[model samples]
Target: MYHVVVALDEDADRARRQSRAVADLPQAAREVRATLLHVFTDGEGASATEVGAVRRASDVLNNAGVDVEVIERSGEPAATVLDVADRVDADCICVGGRRRSPAGKAIFGSVSQSVILQADRPVLVTGGFEE
Candidate 1:
């Protein structure tokens, strides 16, 4: 199976885009296993499956016949995502990219950028839907 760690955030659009990218993979139903990961920065005890963005992404992947699992964690987003991806031995890490200025990224730090740069495996970055 081609295992993937899909890092999701509160942005429903970004989640949808990330899910589509995975679902569109070759033989997704037969070969892809997606782990939907959500990191809670705030100390909320909410389940990952309960998050709106995660639910929407799960629906999309389910409709496309991809095997899915949901995991929730509390920590720094990028670091948590990387640690989970490593633990899962993911073949790829999927993340949604937000448009940010270089300076903005420099100051705020980009999760997608961090994952891309740090992951030992391939990273797939899906852009937010253009309106």
Candidate 2:
């Protein structure tokens, strides 16, 4: 089975989309195991809302019969994601890139962009949430 890390931020809809993207990966020959990851930068534990988001994504993947593990970390989002990927030996990283203009991204930075640039493994980026 292949292991994948789903980067879930505060956006619940985006998190769901990322989870669905992982679950939709071709499972014809081998099963896909998913690690639902959320990072709390303050080194605090996950908040209730964050936990709820994880649960929502977990439910989607679990209901699809995909092996799922929920992981919460304390650190910078992109760096922690890469760290977790290494620890989990992830085959790929899945994340949602919220809509942002070139100027905005340049000024504010982007976790998705950082992961795509630095990740040693494949990174799957989904567009922002849909209605």
Clashes of each: 0, 0
Would you give me the overall lDDT of model 1? 0.93
Off by over 4 Å in 2: 28-30, 47-50, 129-131
Local distance difference test values of all predictions, in order = 0.93, 0.84
- Candidate 1 per-residue lDDT, tens place, 43-121, comes to 9888988899999999999999999999999999999999999999999999998887778878988888888998899
What candidate 1 gets wrong by more than 4 Å, as runs, is 129-131
lDDT of 2 by residue, 1-131 (tens): 88999988777788788888887889912599988898888767656335767888888888788998887888799999999999989999998978888788889899999999999999999888322
Q: Alpha-carbon error at 116 in model 2, in Å?
A: 0.3
State TM-scores per candidate: 0.95, 0.89
**Worst window of 10 by summed lDDT in candidate 1:** 122-131
Where does candidate 2 clash, by residue pair? none
Error of 1 at 30 (Å): 0.5
RMSD of each: 1.6, 2.5
Candidate with top TM-score is 1
Looking at model 1, residue 15 earns an lDDT score of 94
